[model samples]
Each structure stands twice: as C-alpha cells, then as structure tokens.
Target: MLYIVSALKPEAQAFVDHYKLKKSKLNNFTIFSNYNIRLIISGMGVENARLATQTLINNFDITDDDTYLNTGICGASRSYTIGELIECGGVNYNGIDHIFQENRPIISCVSEEVATPSYELADMESYGFYDAVIHNPAIKQFHIIKVVSDHFEPQKVGKEETKSLLFNVIDDINKIINF
Candidate 1:
C-alpha cells in the first residue's frame, strides 16, 4: 500500500484524478483511496499535518509493505524555478533536523513562510508530517516530495498557481512511487 500525504486539495487533485481514486470521508478529512493507494490532505500547517497524518495512520492498518509519502508544493529560494521537483532528504523543525538517505536530497525547513532563506526548500507541513510519522512502528518507507511554487513570496501563491505547480511534478511523483 502507498499513502501520499498532501497539504491542499489542489496538491492532491492530480493524483486523485490520475489514479481514479475514490473519495471517502474520515472525520472532517478527505481521503482519496483506491485498493492499494491512499492520499490524505493535511490542510496546510504544522499542527494539521501532524494530526492528520496520525489520524490516517491510526485509522488504517499500516504495515511494513506500505509507503508513506508527503507530496505538496513549497515556497523555495529564488534560485530554484517554480515547478521544480525536490525530493527532500532532510527536514528541520524548530532547529531540529531529520535526515534521510535518498537521491537528490535537499533540506526542507518546515515552518510558515516569512523571509525565505537559501535553504533548499521551505514549507509549512513537512516537519509536522515527518515528526508524527517517525514515531510510528510501521517499519517501512517514508518520503517527502515537494514542487517549488513561490520564491519565498507568500503573496505570489494562490490556489490556481499551486495546482499548476503540483501538476508539473506529478510525473516525478509517479516515478518515485513506482520505484
């Protein structure tokens, strides 16, 4: 089973459409799931990401075979163009870092975007997602894939733009999941 966690409805739309996933209500959260795949939208924030991830994993019988992935669009430094795919290798939350062994790894500073620094990536959700899931005894894989959306400018981000940014990396996300 593969579980893809997203932060917004737009971020998850491509996968839901591509996979023909069926929507089921779990509490107030919308879960898009098929036989072997589940996509949960955490709704943009550290606390929401943590709570939503914990809720979904708790409600389901996650096993070693299942893979948990957090997929979304992020605010990045101007050096990275919009719509670039980044497979986060590490995440920093409240100055604490969680490093991973992966390809093209970048550090994601998970927090509300204010003045985006030169960090590889910045988002409001990844740290919370990783923080909560790391405690789970699922004994398997977890990855973070984010598409560059804003150049550290929150005013430039909108729902339509987020959808477009996420669309650019759906193929990369598909490859990651298949691999």
Candidate 2:
C-alpha cells in the first residue's frame, strides 16, 4: 500500500484517472484510492499538508511497508528547465530546514511562490507533508517528487498547463516509485 499526497488536483489528476480511483471523504479531506494506492489532495500550503496527512493516518490502516510519496509541480531555478523531475532532499519551512534521506540534493523552500536562487525548488506543501509523515509510526521511508514547472513565475502556469506538466512526466514518476 502506497499513500501519496499532492497539493493540487491537477498534480494527482493523472494517477487518479489512470488508476480509476474511487473518491471518499474523511473529515473534510478528499481521499482518492484504488486497491494498491491512496492519494490525498492537501491543497496548496504547509498547514493543509500537515492536517490532511495526520487525518489520513488516523483514519486509515497504514502499514510499515506503505510509503507516502509527495508528488507535485514545483518552482525551479533558472539552472533547471521546465518538465524536469527532482527528488527533494530537504525542505526549508519558516526559516528552518528539514532534511530527508532521499539522495536527490535539490533543496526545496515552502511558500506560496518565491524566487529561485534562494532554493533549488519551491513549493507550498512539501515541508508540511514531510513534517507530518516523518512522525508516523508506520512510516519509515517517505519520498517527495517535484517536477520543475516554474522559473520564479508560477502565475504564468494555468490549469491546463498544470495538468499537462504532470501528465507528461507521469510515466517517469511511476518508474521512480515502481508503481
């Protein structure tokens, strides 16, 4: 069982549709699941991620072998091109940095949107997702996968573009997690 988290609907659109996921509501959160995987959209923020993750774990029978993979589009520096997939090694939230065991060195900063040079990647939810899942007893291995979708200008990306970006790299994401 793999429990995944995404901050936006478009980010999880590919997997939800591809797997023919069924939707369920738990404490005001939307949970979409198939037999092998479950994905919860935490909206786009640190607090949302924290609350949604905690609620999911409290409501479900998550196991040690089940992994929580955070997949979404992230803001990238000019050094990285659009559509590039990266595994965030650490996340900086509220001036504090939280490092992870993932080998990918791309550091992420959590905010609504921000400049690229301050961090290699920027998103609104990774830190919150990491913070909550790291404390779960059933969780030992967690992953954060980001696709570079913006270069300091996330407003330029629209709904259609957001879905397209994730769709284009869904195959790679599946391969990375062996889904």
Off by over 4 Å in 1: 102-106, 115-118
Per-residue lDDT over 1-179 for candidate 2, one digit per residue giving the tens place of the 0 to 100 score: 88888888888887787778898887788889988888898988889998888887887787767778888888887889999888778887777777775466545656557754577678888888888988876787688888888897877888778888888887888787776
Per-residue error for 129 in candidate 1, Å, reads: 0.8
Clashes of each: 0, 0
Which ranges in model 2 have alpha carbons more than 4 Å from their true place? 115-117
Worst 10 residues of 1 by lDDT: 102-111
RMSD of 1: 1.9
Compared with the true structure, what per-residue lDDT tens digits does model 1 show for residues 104-154? 565565556656565667888988788878998773788888888877787
**TM-scores of all candidate predictions against the true structure:** 0.89, 0.91
Assess the local accuracy of residue 109 in candidate 2 as a C-alpha lDDT between 0 and 100. 52
